[model samples]
Target: MATPIQMPSLSPTMKEGKIVKWLKKVGDKVSSGEAVAEVETDKSNLEIEAFDDGYLLQIVVGEDQMAAVGAPIAFLGAKGEKVDAGKSAAKPAEAPSAAKPPPPPAPAAKPAAAPPPAAPAAGGGGGGRIAVAMPSLSPTMKEGKIVKWLKKVGDKVSSGDAIAELETDKSNLEIEAYDDGTLAEIVVGENQTAEVGAPIAYLTAKGGKAAAAAPAPAPAAPAPAAPAPSAPAQASGGGQVVPLRREEPAAAGGRRLRASPLAKKIARERGLDINQVRGSGPSGRIVKRDIEEALTKGVSAPAAKKAPAPGARPAAGVRPEPQVVPLTSMRKVIAQRMTEVKPGVPHFYLTIEVDMDAAVKVREEAKAMDLKVSVNDLIVKAVAMAVRRYPKINVSLQGDHVVQYSTVDVGIAVALEEGLITPILKDADQKGLQAISTEVRELAERARKRALKPDEYTGGSITVSNLGMYGIDQFVAVINPPQASILAVGAVADKAVVINGQLAVRKMMTATLSCDHRVIDGAIGAEFLRELRGLLEHPTRLLF
Candidate 1:
């Protein structure tokens, strides 16, 4: 019996996956639990393994192809049995020229052997087109510039291999090829920008001979003649082309020059376009190396008028110029989620000051023992212990029910190059400070590199965001959706306080807990924070 191998749902949020590669080909024997293919989800690339021992029958989804979750990607059959090759593979012939006309086979022209049917063009080979969309490089990036392509038309690309580099507002990011296939076409060019989700290229599963043949004769035509000089001059000046004057010189000789005092001043400062420089100073007398100095400085020549400040209303005669950028997929999601949380959930914040002298001393003691635990790790441990005592704060809003989690999965907010991401430290209460610190560091490093798996970013019962390293005295963070509260930790500071009627300086830290009103009321949230403060103030409670 043949069993259809459907694309497995690797993550709860995964809608589709791109086939990275097939480890086994048709007719190869696959054992249960053996990796058969690699697939890339939105978050990470995962290996797809075979579930049962069988012969590889067919690959329905070619490498680099994307299939919706649960779609058939391959098939398996009994070992040694013939497998269906589907609609591809050539059919067997009935007979080979029954009445063969022999003799005098030599031809005058040989017909050029039909040019051996030129190999299918890179991306057009497959009958169907696979759209390569512009990738969102950052959470706030709405569009990206196609800086350059790493793969050209007809080049074969494998999964995980960089296909192009995209420039977002934040930084340049390498985009990977989703499937293994010939790059069919490049719809976007270098320096050209496109919105996220827009098609930047196309990939065909099979090479297209017809499309490949279409460009063979394109280079035969001569290049178009250059446009008239005046046309370019007007366009460069941001104006419509004007007819050339009858008295104008047929050709402007080398360095046809002129300059003004203001032009020279601007030139010295900016390295301006001297030839295009217009002098506002007294009668343009080709002032002392004006244009030359400007050109050397590379500064913008004087404009006809000054530009207004950004977003400022223009005068009656002028309309304000505005630049528009589309919202990127990541940015769009962030905006939507933020709006939903802001208005839909009633939020209340509780702030408390904790004495961190003991906590710092404990950390110093741990460091002496070769355990370099961070203040964050200490806070995480304290929060986990507090949650164990006050479980109500470690719950999420799930429709009519408040889902309380038994185990503590603490989400430590990390700032990545792309944006903010929170990776979980599971069972934080069960782990020691050193273990939590190591895991948090590893997760943060991975988050910055966009290498975190979906599981790392999901299933956290609580979240913690700290800006103490940055010297933030105090701040409050919105609760992550579904989760009841988020803890914001501020920097530890020395403050003068009255202890038993004596003024003394003590190390103190401020923390603010933002709770979702539906899941955690002010009293419950405050009690949790009080417990956390007590643990930090005592420092030994975390160990117990």
Candidate 2:
């Protein structure tokens, strides 16, 4: 009897793979240990061979298509035998997205081998446990540290409750339950690390036989789940059934402001202090209607002075006894990314100097109005405005696709004791100088306290790394992966230069832009720098 050969799990973490190409054709003779097709896995592309001697009968899954682990890809059988695929008991496979045209009728052969059986139920909730796995908190994250467990074994939890807080590469994130269940077991303990997609805990369905665990059909993969609970869910921070982030009053310096994104954007645009408009939405969350009402009530926006940079503690001598300190998640990610970027990615550098006298004058005027405007704030706004002209530099290379982002989201790299995190200033191109200044200050403060959410620090079109506060004249920065360019801003110091063909002292800052050669060409990088330099030099134009 002809049998379907299921797709094999080449890598432990690979849930599915794209069929790159088939090495054999339909009706071709396939023998055991013969390579039949190539599959592109999560890490790399490898050839999948046949496990049994048979003639190729039919290709169940086509080329350029994806098949889930343990799904059928092709059929294999003895010569002169015809298989009835339609009557086969296997569930038909569907394309994840827009299905590509089926590959030309060619030699259909057996898969390299069958996938291994699923692992035993986690949390010891055999056949009924809803195991929660570690999700990828950030795009480049491989694993996460279990900071602490909010729920323990035998504790009943409702849908949308935070089960645990996982320390990711970028920030500390809370993973919530999608369905009501009792925590059956804790597979990973506090202060330990687990790879993404690895089970950290298990849950038993509500009213189940025991508080042990439930199977997939029972409590996993809820209809409304973005990362269905059955698998290591993507921990969207907040999902529909239960919100990870409650719209409670979050600290903005001392004042707590809770508002919807639309309301905040409207408030920022109207130059109104959102804090003045009391929220009337759920849990006092300010909505768009509230902002409109406030506008009608003649509420004006107030410019907040940027938070003062915290002063460093007094220098103390090292302790007499030496001890090794464990590396943080941030530090570990930085080390891995730094190691891969140097040798794997090609980089080209471009340096440009800007006269900050105009920017300096603007800052002084802002200070007179009690607004805290810094030199870096000006650069951030300028870069945001500059990227609008050349959108290619603001795109990311995702697999084979070049994803052009819709907004000029700029990342402001904030230095911390453990490491550094780049908090995204979303839609910076549309924001005013005051908004950028205040937002950056607030983000830096949260970053230092390790209170930032994943969305705040990930997915930026470009990054601005300024070392001017450290008294560094100029230095190039390594490119953050996937981003085409990173701007390195240096200190504004008195330098002798020929301006208008005359030697004069001017406050000049040198900026170096490190660009990835694969995504950005030299011409595009130069144009962006030229535009940035112009915007910073003519500081007044940035307002328009």
Candidate 3:
């Protein structure tokens, strides 16, 4: 019987993947539990392992070819079995010899040697138990840096026990054991990185006999000290060096090519080629060291002679300055989305100044009680509560019919080193002040690290943007489409005002509400803001 190798969905949101490489070729003997190929999904590159052993009969997709999940990529069958080469099941394999006419090979021979017996499952030495891959901590996190391991191999573990501390792009997360069992082996070490969905360790059922058959324990090793300079190089099984051939030189006028700052730094220190460097970094990025190492090793041609002084240049036109920039993925997305929304949606802006003296007093009082809550948290709670009071502003615009939300999910804009992401406070109206504060802190930390899930960024009824920390007075925000409005908060400062016919100073904060005219009218939006302003000013209303 032939086994179909279909593309597996690496992540819940992954729709397609690009075949990055084939570890085994057709006619090669395969075994269950052996890796056969590598696939690159939207999130990360993962190895696809064989589920059944057999001879590689056909490869349906070649390297770099994209296929949707469940699409067949290869097939396995018995040796000497005739495969339907003409069937749609087989995709053209990527072969260097296929590009040009090649000499015919000798007559078909017997299939190659079979793989070794399958290794013992991580936890199963005496009883059968499966290993659970580390859960993805965030969307942008491809790999996690292991900070420490809480359990040693052969230690007993129970569900929900913290097994490891994972340093993600956002924060340090504790990886929990998902099953009750004995730890079999740790595939990855402390400080080492394991891609999302890649097995990090194994677990065996408690008191299972299979646990005694576990392989000899390998010595624990330290994780990578720091982030790799270049995109992570794929490692072959057994850690053997796989020679990578460069198809083209990456130099100009004998000078090594230029790439990213990080790449450049790495290149300068290592002396590598910029062109031959295949960036596995974010978005196929090439960096500095990729070029530097090539240069140091004499991989690229020697540097050319320096050009004449600027004044010695021939009386030609003025020299143009080169523009240097490092655009992040988030910035690029923001640019494209803003451009799309500006042209397609009719936008309207409204600004309102909210008196926050009471809110400030309440927060101060809460602080005295050791409840360190922020004004933003209170605003989030207030907005969620107000949405229920004013359902018109909580609605999303849909074609023909208006889509109104019964529950309020408030999105708080959090800024990261690379970009900005919004992590929603699910059912904010139902959560109390302390709960909202804790969740906001957690989500903000995750958002900054790019670890938020897709659901965390979508399906929000309204958004809140605060520049109070930066001391901005007030500013109107562009409406994030589908939802009706977004609130922009400015700095809270003391200003002179008349109180009961006497001159006094009062703490004031300005808030601007940007609304989508298609769904929320001026009067309706204004009323909502008015109510929000009253809550913030009185502060006691929030306590009630």
Per residue, candidate 1 scores C-alpha lDDT tens digits across 62-175 of 544555555445567776543333211201100111122431123211211211121122223425455566754333446889988998998876533567877665445566
Taking all chains together, each candidate's TM-score versus the true structure is 0.48, 0.59, 0.45
Give lDDT: candidate 2, residue 30: 93
Off by over 4 Å in 3: 1-13, 16-68, 72-132, 153-161, 177-185, 202-350, 357-378, 390-406, 411-426, 431-465, 475-486, 496-507, 513-531, 534-544
- What total of clashing residue pairs does each candidate reach? 18, 17, 39
Q: Give stretches of model 2 more than 4 Å off.
A: 1-127, 207-213, 216-343
Report the C-alpha lDDT of model 2 over 225-341, residue by residue, as the tens digit.
111121222222111111112221122233324455667778899888766565443223466767788788675321221122132311111101112234446634544465477
TM-score of 1: 0.48
Cα lDDT tens digits, model 3, 47-145, are: 788878788776554443455555455667888665653132222211211232331221101010111011222223445444546555555667888
- Model 2 C-alpha RMSD to native: 17.2
Name the weakest run of 10 consecutive residues (lDDT summed) in model 1: 219-228
Clashes of 2: 17
User: Model 3: what TM-score?
Assistant: 0.45
Arranged by TM-score with the best first, the candidates are: 2, 1, 3
Off by over 4 Å in 1: 1-126, 134-148, 158-162, 165-180, 189-197, 207-344, 398-407, 414-427, 443-459, 497-505
